[model samples]
Target: MTRMRADLLLLLAAFIWGTAFIAQKYANDSMGPLSFVGARFLLSWIALAPLALYERGKAGCASLGKSDLGLAALIGFCLFAGAGLQQIGLVTTTATNGGFLTALYVILVPLIVWAITGARPRRIVLLAGVVSIFGAWLLAENGHLQKWTSGDALILIADIAWAAAISLVPIFLARCDRPYFLAFAQYGVVAFLGLVGGLGLESFSGEGLAAALPAILYAGLFSGGIAYTLQIVAQKYTPAAEAALIMSLESVFAALSGALLLSERLTPLALLGCGLILAGAILVEAEPALRSARMVVRRRRR
Candidate 1:
């Protein structure tokens, strides 16, 4: 695909993922968090099976070892936690809040890397983190950091889990060289855990599941299969930095979709907070490009 077409595909993917927040919230109206997670991922597993299987015979696909499987399982658990908590949070939080909060994961990943590896993050990364926190504080009810609602707190915690999952997936893929299969395994792990959690902690009813079917299918099939496929394909042609910047628009789309479709309105302060958080994420993804351009300018001057 042409670069422009690839970027548009990515934009479409972001739109789909952003709007799926509505479906997730709707699912919670009838089903519990874990139940919805289980049902959603179960469908995701099925929808993705063919693609994952196709990758199984690809050249880079490697036989997984016990340690690799263990790592994949851990990543799956992290994903499960992230997705489940986000769903639970959506039950009480507006989709706009959930989307902005979830976007914090991009900034959080650098902090997570620093924590694990003791490598100092660039000043830009630190600034981005601070900006995101300030934005989150603004985004909170009453514009106070301490005044975060329970749902907001859950969404923040989910971002931590998402950061962990994001950081570890590269390691897993490096070792296994099976991106789709790892995804397959991770989805299965999430599905299994969600099912177990739903059975143990939440009441399950067929009527509830039936009521949630549209949400489940939209979140699982469209968000999972179509959007994900678009992302994978688009990334092949787009620069990584450009891809990251574009994908970050997912939060913006989420907020707009929530406001337009769900009648969720944010205060001016909250909107400012969303802008700061988005700016922080954009900075995180754009810094390398900025630095590169600066270096080129310096060389030209010399």
Candidate 2:
């Protein structure tokens, strides 16, 4: 797929995830976070199994070495950490706060990539990252000076896990070009971990399961099965830096979704935060063309 198409996929995934905050928050009302996460990703793993098998069959390759398993396991741990904490955070935080706070990974991704590879991103990418984080802060705080809650703190930690998971994707994908399998593998790991954690820490009931069924289906099928699969495939084509910015739009989408669906109204300051987030996304989008034009001008002078 072209980078443009890959970016569009990320954009769509952002929308799905943005709306999914509502489902996630709703699920928290009926079940413990661990139980909800277990059910969600377990369902998603099942949904993706057929597609993963089809990809393996079409490629005529299903050879996963020990290294592949190792990488997938590491990614799974990061994903499990990230997804589990974010779900737990949604229980206490507003969907808007959860959405924007979760976007902290957009800033962390570059730093993690730099730390891992020692390759600096473009100046504009750095600038976009700074702008996006500021916007996130504003959106999350809504121009108020308030102490951070446990939920907010949880999502912040989840951002670190998200950045680690995202940075590792390129490394794994370079060695193994199977997006579906990787996604499936991580989902399986998360499902297993979540289920195990839930069983040990929280009690489950048939009524809770029934109460959260709609949310489980929405979070599992659309957010996990469809959106996350799109993320893995899109990241194969899109650069990680650009992909982070594109996906960061999920914050804006989450705010809007919260407003429309949950009647979470935003103040004027919050509106400015949303606008700034879009500005950052637009700047990230324009950076490549801007650089190419500058190089063209320099060539003409030469």
Candidate 3:
């Protein structure tokens, strides 16, 4: 597929993921957080089985070494932990707060990369981080940090975990070529871990299972399967900085979907937070545009 097509697919994938927060909320109502996550991952794993087989047939899955498996498992665990924590946080947090807090991962990614590899972010990224921090404060506390709730705090923690996961992806992907297989393995590990946690804490019920199945299926197929695959493809062609900017649209889409579908109202402060997040995203992605502009200027000067 062309780069343009891949980029468009990634944006659509972000929209699907943004709206998935609502579906996750609904599913959580019927099942425990871990249980709901387990169910969704189970379905996702099943759906990915065929794709994994196809990828493996061409590349030989056995070629993946011990280190690759270990890295994949770690990524899967991080994914599960982040999702599971976010689900727990949502039980007490407003959807708006959850959406805004989750987007903090974008800011955290650069910081995490800097810490891990000693690579400094560009000026725009630093500026965006400052803006995103301000936005997060507004969204979580309306500018009053003392007003923050436990749920909001939990979501913030999940945001950190997600940032780590995002930073780790480049490292893992560098070691492996089969994105589909890696994706499948990641979800499969999460499914297993989620089920173990769910069974340990809560008993499963048929009625609850039936009630949450639709939401779980939607999250698994669209959010987990297609959206994740698109992200992988898009990341391959798009620079990480640009991809992060596009993915930041998740917050905007989530807010709009929640307003339209759930009848959720955004407070003025929350809207301001959203705007700040958009500004931050633009700042984070500014390097590419600046470079392009500089190239054009040089050609014109010639």
TM-scores across all candidates? 0.80, 0.93, 0.87
Ranking by lDDT: 2, 3, 1
- The Cα error of candidate 3 at residue 96, in Å, is 4.0
The segments of candidate 3 whose C-alpha lies over 4 angstroms from its true place after superposition are 1-7, 59-62, 133-149, 239-242, 267-270, 299-302
Error of 3 at 301 (Å): 3.7
lDDT per residue (tens digit) for residues 1-302 in model 3: 66567668768987998889789988878888888888888888889899888988984455788998898888788889888899888888876567667777777777777887787777677677677667755664465543447888888888787777667777776777777877898889889988899989977898998999889989999998888777776666664544665677777677768779879787899779778867876664566668889999999999
lDDT of 2 by residue, 66-180 (tens): 9998998999899999999988887777655666678789888888888988988878888988888788778875745345578989999999999898888887888888889
RMSD of each: 4.0, 2.0, 2.8
Q: What TM-score quantifies how close candidate 2 is to the native fold?
A: 0.93
The candidates, ranked best first by TM-score, are 2, 3, 1
Global lDDT scores for all candidate models: 0.74, 0.86, 0.77
Instruction: State, as a TM-score between 0 and 1, how close model 1 is to the true structure.
Output: 0.80
